[model samples]
Target: MSAIASSTSPQPSSSPGTTRNTNVTILLACLGVFASYLPVVGVAVALPVIQQALDASTAGLQWVTDAFILPTAALLLTCGMLGELYGRKKVYLAGLTLFCAGSLVCLTAPGIVLVCVGQALAGVGAAALLPSTLALISHVCPDRRKRARAIALWTASLGLGLTLGPVVNGVIVEHLSWRWIFLPSLVIGVMIVVVGMAFLKESRASRDPHLDVPGQLLAIVAITGLVYGVIEGGSAGWASPAVIAAFLVAGAAFVAFVVVELRSPCPMLDMRLFGSRAFSGAAFVMTVTLFAQVGLVFALSEYFGLVHHASTLDIGIRLLALNGFTVLLGPLVGRLMNRTGPGLLLVTGLVISGIGALCVCFFHASTDTGTAALVIAVLGVGIALAMAPITTIAMNSLPRRLAGTAGAANSALRQIGSALGPAVFGAVLTDRTLATLPAHLAESGLNPADQGQVGGVVAHVGIQAGAFLRLDTPTATERALSAYGASFTDALHMCALVSGIGMLVAAAVALVLIGVRNRSPHDATPEPATA
Candidate 1:
């Protein structure tokens, strides 16, 4: 084992030329994060249009987002080490290059499969970009206060990308093809690559970085298997052989991962970090909170496009209520963080988020725009409140020596939750809606043959089949529409119950495990960050 990197201040002489270089590096680093997060929510917002255009299934739609997130999550820990061994600037630009390539692929894709492939490529790029950007900032601004400020701006840029995803894609898809969603990302990515290559200085650590290849592969399999099982189970059947196999593989791989980490001399994640109650509690809170936030974004997008038949731009505007508060409440959230305990803030936020999700249970097909926005705003507020405290809880609970791996693991878990959010929520929505759709159709006063015909169309077209439910005689479109809406609303209720109750349960767990006290030992100093 080697001594860590951040022992002393590495701030360069405060000259005008050096200052200019540092500012430019920070700008590029911020842009890298912005680009990484841009498509995360954007792709989810575009799910409805992609489904309709490609005639995709529920599982296929889940993959469209998960493919990007899965690789990003699985490879995150490894990528940082790679950058440390090689060079941060090179890895940073490599990440943008791949992201641009993914965007190009998406721009030209003719099928859902191709789109997923493109997203997977972008996911790999994101994995590389996130950590290298942080390393660049750490390298350029070595003074603790300045680095902190740079990281804050970097964090804000990430939130901006997430917040704006819906609006950007909404505007683009409304005017052109859904594929145009990638055009802006593509152009920015290419520009960054070109500029960064010219001006971005290279930096690397002094040692050959440790590689945990086996643990990395196992972690990937575990997450991919779990998500695939959930998504495919709904589309196929719960008892299907493939689903059974995926679950079994995931379970086995997870166990193997724990064992490998415990025994490895140079583990990717320090398993002992979870021994702290605060660390465990904070990790759980982040995972569950993000699960609700990202999952709800997906559900609402589908609701607006399929249930209410809203335009792309309108759907984006309505969804804005969900994330707009995060940006608006930024200063407030920061002030509250200083005045309150992370555990307490997390608990309060979860309770408020639970109430917000519970409110979503009341929404129906005819629910007006204003009412829906109000409920989403409450949920968004809770998310914003709960989000930042997670970092405090996790980082403070462990020794400074564990900072890099601890941060990496905490971040990886959050991404895992993100990947699963759409997979699990979309699956639940599809399962309940399809299972009870027949009963609603039967109650529509339509005869058996006509009922079966409409059912077939629903099967072929999936949730957005409301537009194709016309009948020749004796059957009215209103009856079919009523049946479909009722079924979908019932399904949405199940998702709401899960999200609402899940948050409350997570709050209880946090209360049991976390404390308000300062938990870190003062004996060890923080090692220098070695991206």
Candidate 2:
């Protein structure tokens, strides 16, 4: 086996200037990660505004979000491989440039289609940026303790972005315009480019491997098709031909992707990485974590807006309970990781988060926001404990040379979960709302004919359940409002149950697969780079 050392392998630097440069590098990488994540949650606050401005349907709003997620999730592995083959700095800069351009396009987008196109462009940029940012950190910080701290900071920056995205966007959309949401991201993108050019050093693999074009294509098709099917299944019946075809295409593409990767000499994602229990377990935990986190974020954002008639600012504030704890506790958790081992943190975190989610299942329209916030804070604590440590464990499981691939694979899986979270949760929420709407309406003392008429309106406007709640018209009757509230509450309960169940399963997986032994800092053992 040929070992190709990464150029980023840490060198001792005692000089003041070198230390300052190292700090700057970490900052720049964190900024890059921050930029990539900002859009993911920030845009949720703006969805209603965009829908109103563009006269977009619920599916259109979903596509606006999914457009970005699809490409980001699909292309992450390819971009990660390219970063190693080309140069990490070069790819990083290019991603920032594209992201800036996409932001500009979104700022000026006249319709939802244009906005979605711009989002897709940004997704492509994020695909390049996410893995490279982590790889750069792994390269610069060699000491396990220092690396863990840096990774914690990196995770915190992501949480900060996720934390700020909604609040900032909410304030902007409320006081200014939805278009201004992209402005800060645009400025940040430009600033990062300048800082990257000045301080970021170039790093790449010692030898370039063959690009896996077929594997890349298959992966993209599979992911895009699956996301499409999930999103469409909510509005278009699950049995609809279009939805069925999307699932079939996704399945076939996934099978083809596996075959191509197994055959390719230099596959984008090495299938063998799953052979390591630690690596596979970490990946599974990540997917499950994001699935629950992102889905709840999406669902609850709508819940706040639709059920409570929360202003954008209020919705953002409500979400802070979940994200704020993540940002605040991330570094502390990182510091403790050496003593705890990831297994304990993972199991403990998932269980706590599951409990939080299960608690939320009891919420109703009249439930106090304080009660919801308290439970969400518990969920946040769980996420903080698990998030950074999982990354550390996954990277440590691989050889130094394959760190880039490891980061990419871990990130790609997380994004896949992120995408699925919203799609599946949204689908379930919509289905539950439709099923329960009639019963709730009838019980509210509406005549049979009136109930039928209200149901038609719900079928049309209720595609975007949250947005439909905001509508002021005939269906906004006292009884109709009550029915919609009850229906949404029912949906929220189901969504929370699903999230809780997923976390429990993840906790079980962590116990079975993650190692309980903590590696000593002095023990420097390298695993073979088989992939």
Candidate 3:
């Protein structure tokens, strides 16, 4: 192994000037991450407009979103490993360059195919940008206390990006053309490149060179099969041969990944970290909480738009409760983690979130804004509490030298959770809605033709069927809503139950990680910053 792979990240000095520069470096990293994430949410809101304008197919529309996620998820570990082997600064700058190029591709692309290609390019940039920022935080704040605070800020930027992406997209789509979505990202990417060139410093890798190509290839195959199976299985019957094949492929790929990783030198992830109680526990909670929160937000957005007839602006505003508290709570949560341990915060957050999900079970088609807000707000609070400490424990569990890889692993786990949560919940809701269709159609007293119309391969019948079923008779409204209510409630209950399991996993992890003590003053000093 080369010395580059075995070395530790450089430490920044504690001097005031160095501290300021460290903050700047963190800011630049955050900006890059923020810009990368902008496209995910922004493009989603712009999708309908793009489809309308460009005559895109359903598959093309899906690709517009999936293109970003597939590459970002597949290559996260690779980017993290690259940072460890080459240097954080060089890799980070490279990511920014790709991001700029991708944004430009989207801006100038002639059709939907090219747009998907652009998103794929952006995903690569996002993969690199996400883990690098966390690694940089580990390097910049060598002291655990300051590092916790810095991570809090970094996580806050993530929330900001997600929260703002749709709002920005809505503005651009309403006033200008859909292509304008890529314009701002281009400007931001250039800014990140310029700032990185001026301020960022290169860091030495922590270990000798061993690229672990076999492990990486296996991991990619595994994740691709899994994501593909997930998206397709929901539409294709679960019992269908295609779905079964996807699952089988995914399972085989997973087994291959484990075998390859165990044998490879310098594997992308250090699987042994799972042996640390704290690392495993915190990571488990992260995946669960992310699944619950991100999945719920996705479901609710559609509910507001399709069922409640909310406009794009209205949907954005109404959905604010989901992520709004996350930004507000960052600093306070950081200070609280500094005062207390991660165990208390994580457990409390999960419990609160589980309760919030349960509240959605009581929701009706006629649910008022205040009630809706209250339900989402509870989930948001839970998310606010859970996010900070889970990260704290995950990073703090390892020795400083392994922080970069650990951060990458933690992030990959969370993204996996985010991806899975929506897939599972969406499937449940979709299946239950279809199963209840006969009961609803009979109750509506619609003719056979009308019933057929309601039955003909509707998307999200779970959400919109309630309103349409009530349109015929005023007295029928209550009974019609009852059926829809029952179905939606069943879906919510399932989601809550699943999320509760996630919470329990988090709580168990916190308990087992055993000891993470308060930082002493000496350990809180700023360490030298690394790229």
Candidate that scores best on TM-score:
2
Clashing pairs in 1: 5-528, 6-527, 6-528
Q: Clashes in candidate 2: how many?
A: 0
Q: Please report, in order, the local distance difference test score of every candidate based on alpha carbons.
A: 0.74, 0.80, 0.72
Cα displacement (angstroms), candidate 1, residue 220, comes to 2.6
* TM-score of each prediction: 0.84, 0.92, 0.89
Candidate 3 stretches with Cα past 4 Å from truth are 1-17, 445-449, 457-493, 512-531
474-499 in candidate 1: lDDT tens per residue? 35677887788888888888888889
Cand. 1 Cα-lDDT: 0.74
Q: For this target, which candidate reaches the highest lDDT against the unseen true structure?
A: 2
Ranking by lDDT: 2, 1, 3
- Model 3, span 421-473: residue lDDT tens: 66777777776766775676677665666556555534444345554564355
- How many pairs of residues collide in each model? 3, 0, 13
